[model samples]
Target chain A: MMHPSAGGVLKPACYAKPLLRPFGLAWIVMMSVAATTQAAPEALAQVDPPTADHSQFEPLQQDFASGREVTRACLECHTEAGKQVRASIHWRWEYRHPQTGQLLGKQHVVNSFCNNVTTNLGRCTACHAGYGWDGPDFDFSDDSRVDCLVCHDTTGTYEKAPKRGGRVLQEPVKVHGHPLQPPDLGKVARNVGPTSSETCGSCHFFGGGGNGSKHGDLDTSLLDPPPALDVHMSDAGAGLECSDCHVERAHQIAGSRYQVTARDRKGTGAPGQRRYAATCASCHGIEPHPLGSDPAALYQGAKLNAHVDRIACQTCHIPAMARGGVATKTWWDWSKAGRLDADGNPVKRHDADGNLTYWTRWGEIEWGEDLEPDYRWFDGTMRYTLPDQTIDPSAPVPINRFAGHHGDPAARIWPFKMMRGKQPYDPVKDRLVYMQLFGKTEQAYWQGLEWQPAIASAMEAAGLPFSGEVSFTETRMAWPITHMVAPAEDALACGECHARDGRMAELTGFYLPGRDSDPALDRWAQLALAAALLAIGLHIGLRILFHRRRRHTE
Target chain B: MTRTVVMFTGLERLWHWSQALLIILLLMTGFEVHGSYSLLGFGTAATLHVLAALALIVVWIFAIFWHLATGEWRQYRPTTRGLAAVVRFYLYGMFRGESHPFNPRPKRKHNPLQAASYLLFGVVISPLLWITGLLYLGIDLWSAPADLPLAPIALIHVAAAYGAALFLLVHGYMITTGRTPTAHLKTMITGREEIEEASQREQQPERG
Candidate 1:
C-alpha cells in the first residue's frame, strides 16, 4: 500500500531507485487527461492492484547465488511454471515449420544481420530464456534452467550477462565504458510479478545487437510511448500490454512472423470470448469503420474497410516504422569487416548522429528512421533459404521469401522492413557460409579479424564441407512491420496509394484507378480533344469572315 | 415583322441548365479522378463525381418523363425532310448569309440536322456514358470472374467522358450562331425568343 518513493521524497539516494516503473505511471496519468475527466474511477480501476506480495514469502528472504537457484525457489509455489517455460520456443530456440518442413528458428536460420547463432551461442544466448545455452549440448529438459526472473522481475533491474550463457552478472562489471552494478537478487526475487513491456522489451527490443536495430516497429520507445507513436500501447489510447495482444497461453505466444495470419475472415470475436489468433480483424472487425451521415466521410471509411480484403490495416495505419526516435539498421556490409587503421588496434567510426557506422568486429552499417516499408503480398507462409540450399551468386539471395501472389485469396499487401546485407558465402559450394563471430577461439572473427579461418572452423563444427572460397553475396531478409500503429487521423490518405508513382507503384498484377492508365487510350483522348478544338476554331473563323463580307457587300 | 414567342417551357429551361451544371461538375471531378490534375483531392473529387452523376441521372429521368408525357419527344424524331438542305446551309449557304433550310415552331423546334444530331446523342452517346459510368461506380458489386479486368471497363468510361466533353465544346459554339451571338443564351433563360409573325401564325394552331 506504500508508495516506493514515499520514504525519502527529497533524498538524492531515492533518485537511484528505479524511476522507470513509477515514472511510467506518472506519465500515463499525465498524458490521459481525457480519461481522467471522463471516468476517473475506471482509470483507477485499471491500475492492477497486486493480490499477493512475494516480499513476505519465506523462500525469497534469502539472497540467491544464481538464476537457477532462484528458479528452484520459484518451483516450490508455481510447480508447472518451469516446465511451461522450458517447452516454449523461447527456451527450445527451434521450430520445424509445419508447411515447409524445414528446421527453422534462431538455431538454424542464417539471418542477414548476425548470420547464424551456432558458433555465436555464447553471446546471442544472452536473450535466451534459459541458463547455460552456450553450447548445443545444453540440456533442454532441465526445468531448473528456466530463468523466471527475466520475465517476472518487477524491480526493472534483472539483466542476463552477455556472453556468459544467460547467467546474471554476479559481480559489478564495466561494459562499453559504462559501470553496471549486479542486480540485488533478493530484492528482485521478492518483487516478482507479471511480465511487463519492459520485461519483453529487454530482449526483443534489443535484438540484432542493439535497441531498434532488428524489428523496425519494436524498440525501447514503446515502454512509455506517446499516443502519437502508438495508439494501441499509449496511455491516452487503449493502454494495452504486450501480452494483451500477443495472448500468451501456457507460455506459447499466439502470434509469430514464421506463421502469419495474413487475412482474418472470421471477423471480430464475441466480447470476452477467447480466441487464439492475434490479428487486427480478431478484435476490430474486418469492417471496423463507422458509417456516418456525411456521404464523403462514409465513402472514405467504407473504401478503407473494403481494402481489408486485399490490404492490411497496418499498410495505412503504420505509415512509417521506427518512428519514435530510434533508428533501425537498414543495411549491413559484412564484406567491409576487418578494416584496421595504421595502428594494430581495431577501428571504429561513428556518423554525424553518433551512430556506429562502421566497426572492425562487424562492418559498415546504415541506420534508418521513420522509413516507409517495402510492400508485398503475403499469405501467412514464409519459406526460408536454408544454409544447404543452392543459391545463385549472380543475383541477390532472398534469405527468407514471403509467399503469396495477388491472386491468392488469403494474400494481402503487407509492409516489411527489408534488411539488406552482403555476407560471406562459399562460392564453389553455392551455400551461405557461417562463421564463428564470438568466443575466444583463434578462428572467431571478433577475436582474429579474419573470415577464412572463422568460416572453416564453423563449417567443420556444423559438419558442412568448406570449399575454401569465400565471396560476399548480397542477401535480403524481410521482417513484417505491424506495430507502432498511428491514430486514425494519421492513417495514410487515399492519394498515397491512388496516385501515379504512389506507395503501390512497385506492386503489379491489378489496375488501381488514379495510378494505372493505358498510354494509348490517353494519347487518343488527347488527340480527339485537339481535333474537336481545331474544328471549332475553323468554324468560328469562317463565320466571322462571312459576316464581314456580307456587311461590306450591303 | 419580328414577334416574341415561347420557345421553351420553364420546366424545359430548368432541366437544360441543371443538366449542364451537373455535366460540367462531373467532367471536372472525373478528370481529377483520372489523375489529370488535382483540384479537390482524389477522395473528394471521386465522391463529388459520383454525386454529380447521380444528379444527372435524376434530371435525365424527369426530362424523359416530361418529353413523353407532353408529346414533345417528336421534336427529336429523325426525318430526312430538308435534312440535306439544312446540312448544306451550314456547310456553305450560312457563310453567304442565305436563308435557313428549316424554320422553328412551338411544337417542332429542332431543324432536320439538329434532330438527327440529338438522335445520335440519345441513342449512342448518352447510353454509353450512363452504362459505363454505372459500371465504373459499382465495380465492387460485380462478383463476376476474377480475371475480368477493370481496365476495359475504365477505358470505355473514359472514352464516353471524352465524347461528352466534345459535345460540350461543339454545343457551346453552336449556341452562338443564333439570331444574335447571345440570342440562344437569353432565350434559354427567359424561355422565349423573337420569331417571324407569319411562322408564328403558321405554327400556332398546331400548338393548341
Candidate 2:
C-alpha cells in the first residue's frame, strides 16, 4: 500500500509517513510506476558502464557479412561516430608532432621494421580502422568504411587477416593449403561493447611481425596478468584497464609515444589539458616512493630520491623487459635474406634459445629475453626519416632519431629497445625505399618472386623513381619500453646503481661517490690531516724541551 | 736488573699479527670497493674483502676463546689507580728522566690508555663495522631488508672505516713511547720484554 503523501513526488520528505492520505491507493500505485519508468534511463546512464545491450536493438538483429556493413548498421543510430573515428590517429594514421612540427605519422615515417606503409596498402591496412584500403586511391571520406567491430567487438572471433585487402571473410577460406574459419562477424557486431585486452592486443601485441617484437614490455601475456607481473592490470590486484591512465575523451586517446610527456611537472591535468596522460608523476606527483606513512611502502633512500632528476620512472620500475615469457627482436638483418634451399624454398635457422635468429621472412632476426634496455637522453621530440630524405651510407642511419643529449635540463635518460637493421635502400638515390613485403594480387612482392619487379612496381605506386638499383643499408631505431610494470619489491635495489661497478657507472658527465674516483683529492685531504697531527706532536715535544731547560736552570 | 718478562704469549702474538694483517687486507680492499682509487679491480677487491673479513672473524673467535680459557683477558683490565701517574710520566716526567709508574707484567700488558682504546675498538667500532659490512654483503640476496635507508647506512659504514684508519695511526705513534723506540715492536715479535722484578707475587691473575 502506498501513502498519498509519498506517492505525489516520491520525495525523501515523505519517507517516514506511516498513515495513508486523502488519495486512493490504486491511483498512487499507478502514478509511482509511471515515475519509475520515466526515471530509469537517467539512472542507467550514471553507472560504472554507460553501454546498453546492443543485441536488443532492432537494427543489430540482422546478420553482418562485411565490416563495412557492420559500420553501416552501427551508423543507423550513432550518426556522428564515423566522423569522430575519421579524426582519430587510429583512423587517419597521422599526427603533426607538436614539438617538432614534423608530419610524423605511420604513413609518412619510415621505421626500421618492414620500413613504411607505402606500396603495401593491402597488407598493412589489415590493422587499419577501415575496409577496402587496397590502393593509394582508397577513399578516406567513406563513412561506411569505418571499422566499428575491430575495437567494439565483444566476441573474440572477429578478425581482419593480412593479404586480404582489409576485407573480413564471411565464410571459411583456405590459406597456404590450410583451412581456417572466418570470425563470426554477425555475432561480434551484435554483441559490441567496451574494448578488452584482446581487442587492443589484436594489432598492438602482434606489431613488427610477432608477439612482443616491437614493444618488448607489451605482449599477449598482459591479457590475463598475474598480480606480480602487472600490479595495475592484474585482475586479482588493482585491476585497472589501459583506459584508466591513457584516458580517452570523445574517441581520441590522450597518450602517445611520439608526443611523450618525458617530465610531467605540473602534476595531473584535466582530460583535455594534458599533452600525454600516461605519466607516473601525473598521478603520484614527483616524489612517488615511500608513498605514505606505512612501513612496507616506504623505500626511504636519500640517493634514490636524488636520482629521479636524471632517470625516467620506467628506467627503475622496469629493470628487465620481455619478462612475460616472450623474446623481443634485438636485431634484424635484411642482407641475409634470399638464402634459398636446393628446392628454391627459403631456409631459416633458430638459435640455442629457440629465438628465430635467421628467418627467411623479411630478414635475419635475433631475439633477446629479459633484456636490459639501452638508455639515452630523450625530451619527447623525435625526427622521422621521410622517403625523400637522403641517407649517408657510411653510418647506420637512425630511422627515428630520439632528440636531446646529456646535460639537457628537459631531458632524462630513458630505457629503449634498440633494433639494428640491414634493410633495403636505393643506392643511386641514397634514400630509403619502401618495399611491398606482403600482398596477394597483381605485382605484390609475396606472390611475385624476386626484388626487381616488386621494387619497380612499388616505386611506381609510390610515385618515386627507383633507378633499378637496390642495396641493403644498415639502419637502427630505438623504441622506448614503457609497460610490463613489476611489483615495487622487484624494482632495482639502491646498491645496483650505487655499487662500485654499478649499472649507471658508464653514465656520462656524472660524478657518483661510490662509482667515481678522485685519488688526488683523497690523498690531499689525508695528507693535510696527517700534517696537522705531526704539527701537534712537534708542539708538544718543543713544550717538553722548554720545560726541562727551565727546570735545569732553576 | 736484567730480568726478562713474558709480556705476550706465542699464541697472543700470533693472533695479534694475524689479525693486524687481515685488518690491513680488509681496509685495502674495502677502500678499493669504495672507489677511493682501486688497486685490485672491483670484482677482485670485493671477493678478497669478504674472504679477509671471514678470516678475521675466525681469528677473533679463537683469540676470544684463548683469552677466556687461559685467564689472559685480565691483561687489558683498565684501572685509574695508576692512570694519573701514567699521564704525568708521558706529559712532563718522561723528559726529566723520571721513574715509570706502571710496568708490563704477565698479567698486566696494557697501560690505562691502551686498555680503554682496545675496549672501544673491540666493543664498539669493530662490531659496528662487522654488522654494517655483513648487512651490505647480503645485498642482491633474500636476507636484505626492504625499505631500508641504504644511503645513511652506507655513510655509517664508511665513517666506521675512517675511525679504524685513525686508530691505526695512533697505535703506530704509541711504539715511540717505549724504553727504546724498538722495545715494544720487538716484544710483539719475540713475545718478551726487559723489566725489573720488584714484585713477583703481583703477577697473579685478578678478575676485572
Using DockQ as the measure, the top candidate is: 1
**Cα shift from native, residue B107, model 2 (Å):** 32
Q: Write out the backbone clash pairs for model 2.
A: none
Give per-model TM-scores: 0.91, 0.66
Report lDDT (Cα) of residue B55, candidate 2. Answer: 85
- Pairs that collide, model 1: none
- Every model's DockQ: 0.52, 0.07
Residue lDDT tens for model 2, B94-187: 6665556677677677888788788788877888888877666543222367544344555566667766776776777677667765888999
lDDT score, candidate 1, position A156: 86
Docking class of 1: medium
TM-score: which candidate is best? 1
> Each candidate: fraction of true contacts kept?
0.57, 0.13
